[model samples]
Target chain A: MAIVSGHPTEKYVRIDRLPHIWCPGCGMGIIFNAFARAIDELGIDPKKIVVVSGIGCSGRASGYWAYDGFHTTHGRPIPFAMGLKLARPDLHVVVISGDGDLLAIGGNHFIHAARRNVDILVILVNNFNYGMTGGQVGPTTPEGTRTTTTPYGNYLESPFNVVWLAAASGAVYVARWTVYHVRNLTESIKTAMQMRGFRVIEVVSTCPTDFGRRNRLPDPLDNLRYLKEHAVYKKNPDPREADIIWGKKFVIGEFVKIEGKETFGDRIRRIIQIAQSRLRKSGSH
Target chain B: MTGEIKPGIYFWSGNDAIAEGAIFAGCRFFAGYPITPSNEVSERLSWRLPQVGGIFVQMEDEIASIAAIIGASWGGLKAMTATSGPGFSLMQENIGLAVMMEVPIVVANIQRGGPSTGLPTMIGMGDVQQARWGTHGPHEIIALSPSTIQEAFDLTIRAFNLAEKFRTPVILLADEGLSHLYERVVVPDPRDVIIVNRKMAKDPRNYLPYKADDDLVPPMAPVGEGFRIQTTGLTHDERGYPAINAEAQNRLIKRLIDKIRKRKHEIIDYEMYKCEDAEIVVVSYGSVARSAKSAVDMAREEKIKVGLLKLKTIWPFPDEVIFEMAKKVKKFIVAEVNEGQITREVERASRGQADVFWVGNYGGRWIYPEEILDKILEVR
Candidate 1:
């Protein structure tokens, strides 16, 4: 078996199915590699890993992984993963999805999961467009950007800043990185895996097949360079200021690192303990 | 040994009995929101579940409540949620998913008046059809109705049992009247009770999550068990991949329906009251059956040959029992909180052998014994 270096094992990967579904030079490949490296470096048992994905190209990552996988409906990965984690706390639950899947249809579950402080990792690949369905405008699609859906000079609409939203919604750990920073992306995933509560890492990747073609960068490599030039590290003093016609300025880094409130599991355990004690006392009375 | 049996027992609602039963059944996780008549189930469970090392959460909404319970169930804990008509409607999509994914869950719907927010606290059996066909597509459902507090406890236990055995969602259908009516319930000890756990796949390797054995029910493994299993709502092959072929679809659908349908003999449950030598039989369930039984007694005082068939298991309707009774009885009077709900099932089961009279009340009121007796007298 031809194994990708730093991948845990063949058992966790579908080796024969490689030459992945993503087009050549797509940034999702970079994100996928970083995720594998993070899992390998963490050294957690492959048997204990679960990757949940929603309906999108990013959702296909679950099928490619060797661990327990779930490819659920659009915008439903959070609740589904919540079930998996709650049922088996020992398992490492990670969710992979696109910007639209997490922010649009599944926005409710995402906020609530973070608010409840469930222990799970969410890796959101923000490629700025709905790539799998032929380059439709998404929640994160820059306003006024030309796409199949928004063909005419786009009407202005601000995109959701997912990292800030998650931070505000009580996520214990929140970070944002682009595909150009592969090492940083891997490190963020590792940190998220170690976090005790809801951790979300938003990866701004290039969708050359859809978003790139719409934006006049038909060549996939040119899209990669665009991300590299415009994306800035949290520590960078002065980064290139490339503005999307209708979206917020692209800034990336680990923006939030707050400690989690009591998790749902912990609360449940406490409730059970209290109930047991009360029952004992009531019996005596 | 000759101590007087408690006739007018302690004042406790049907919801109280269900809560107590769930606790007795070793349910440790309860997630629910407060909705009128069904709210008491949550209230009672919130207090009682904790008393036995169980957790109780009052979720923000019914959707999250069901989701949380599913989470708890997968965590290897017996879990449940309670709601009325509107809340139950909200849970339909997830309920369907649970069925397709073969996740064992128990949902208690205390029926209320509604197409939407019809009666918040009024009694109605409008959800009878919803319980059977609310979520889209073809699948077998196990639903139970209770007439008294004792039956409530008993049927709740059965609901959990059927859910675990079939790896499907089980509905405990109690109307608003029964939910709020107080009666005495005797809970059996856990050791004396038979609890069904999900069949765990012994071998992790080559484990197909959706592959059914001879019983047409697949073994379930927890998420952490090193098993690579996929779950979806789409029609799937044995390996859990979405399959489009007609044969694969037929096999999957048949197994889903047959698992519960074929076990009708084991699942069929009812209480027959003076059904023998009766010219008229009153068919009822939940709280309406209580009135039906009284109506039967009153009819007997007048020397009318009236009988009662109280349905405890409502879905996968007791067709054989009904058919047999139809041959013997002159007429079957279907009494329920809603208009013409269970009456249709009675008519179908009767197959035109006997006249089916529906004595239904839709104004958020329980059917009175006199009203049902009068209807029986008219039919007779």
Candidate 2:
């Protein structure tokens, strides 16, 4: 038998917690892989990385992650991450969770964290449905899609344009990529990590077990084929035109990047300086 | 003057004292939203926390406030948030999360009236029962009540210490009346004040963050440390990994509840005023204790042989004192600001050993000393 080298991203994974809870062709695995590869490639100390996850199938990614993991209550990861980042500016905090977990139940926190421009990275895996709880229709579920709640079809409400929301909420960096674009997603993770303030990378993911069977793409490979044929990689893609349409082409690329902006931490540091200086001048101990 | 006010007597409101007390207790992180009566706690911390090299943030709402404090607690900081009844209601789910994750955080609930904004500007002891059973599921909580303004400062520090000592969330259940009143609080010397920090896991490589020692508190590993600790709100194993089996659920929940229940004697606290040669013991807590004590004194002047049992710690319910007193005392007068909330508790703990009298009031008002005195005389 021939000897084989260990996996390149093995060091950034929790082998003990492995055989993750994600289903077959679940985009969480690929996203987790790309995240590990990005950290490994950038040579950032894994010890400084912290992963905060909310409830859902996608929330399980924190368990398999090698960094410090906090599996918080559903829709609470952003506020938790905000608290961690504000308390310890040295740590690199990242929120990894599903579309329903982030944009739906945690929607208010998502917007506010971006508005505050807190120093944290958010990886929102856009699977269009609540995968963990048997594929219920969620905030990002496209029109005409079938789900557990919407057995026939969903056409009542318009889906949120995530990139637009992020940009409007003052996110410093926002991007979108299908799970098929592995290299691009990896690069986006690296790019977002290097930036200060709130950075959001939406990975348009495939949920074959829940989302696929109800829609046309029943098989795991069918969802991948749909992505492979229809993904349109663009530069600064308009978020309005980037909404995912079932079996139709969707825009995927970096949509916004604003640099040289002051972060919540930077503003807080100035407050600390002024407060302490005033206290010293007053001779108050 | 953020870190520690010099050890001297200062006249301040209960809210102000609570804020200063948090600073004294080495609480470096504050996250909260503005709510009636409790707003001053967050407002002061916003100005003071940063001065002492700590961080203070006003989150979107009380849910986020509770979540943030819990998160910061895991990040190796003593954190707190103050809220009223409505806000406390919103924080219950994550409060349960703190209990599940075994994170140390302090929640100061300067309670106002409510079952949906019942009395925003008024006093309410309606939340005393809620404080104990607000969070869903089978678990135990630690709650402290302050009757005086000075005790607000003193107990806030004690709240943080107990939180860190047990690695569980502690509640400082102050009434709106006590929260807004101004009185003298003696800020302790910094060196003399004892601050307890969470016991950290000694070994990083073989760290089981959820595995408890003899004390039933698992040593905590700071976030972003090399320990790579897993903290979860789910029913988890000793490694903090989610375990769905009935065995894991039973083992984990049993230990979490037992950790506090087993140490009930150490955790329970109350004060007995002139109960030695008395036949009637007036039982009360929070601001209501003040009224109850005054009523007891009135009875004493009339030679009615009455005394007071003032609760300093509300949860783990000082049941032993009540149980013991039930044996000696001829009758029990349970004076509460709310509608007989703690009255039932007194009856249960007394085990029907004595005749129990209930002095109750609605959330919008207080149970006056005269009313309690009338009840004391009627029962006597």
Say which candidate scores most in DockQ. Answer: 2
What is the Cα-based lDDT of residue B268 in candidate 1? 87
**How would you encode candidate 2's per-residue C-alpha lDDT over B197-255 as one tens digit per residue?**
88998768988889999999999987777998888898999988999999999999999
What does candidate 1 score on TM?
Answer: 0.91
* Clashing pairs in model 2, backbone N/Cα/C closer than 3 A: none
lDDT of every model, 2 decimals: 0.80, 0.89
DockQ of candidate 1 is 0.44
**Rounded to one decimal, what is candidate 1's iRMSD?**
6.3
**In model 2, how large is the Cα lDDT of residue A187?**
97
Predicted structure 1: lDDT: 0.80
Error of 2 at A145 (Å): 0.9
Q: Which residue pairs collide in model 1, if any? A: A12-A66, A87-B75, A275-B50, B12-B182, B146-B286, B147-B286
- Minimal lDDT window, size 10, model 1 chain B: B1-10
lDDT of 1 by residue, B224-299 (tens): 7777766666678777766768898798989999999998888889989998889999998888888899999999
**Candidate 2 lDDT, A98-175, residue by residue in tens:** 899999999999999999998999999999899989999999999999899997799875788898899889999999
TM-score of chain B of each: 0.94, 0.98
Off by over 4 Å in 2: A1-5, B1-3
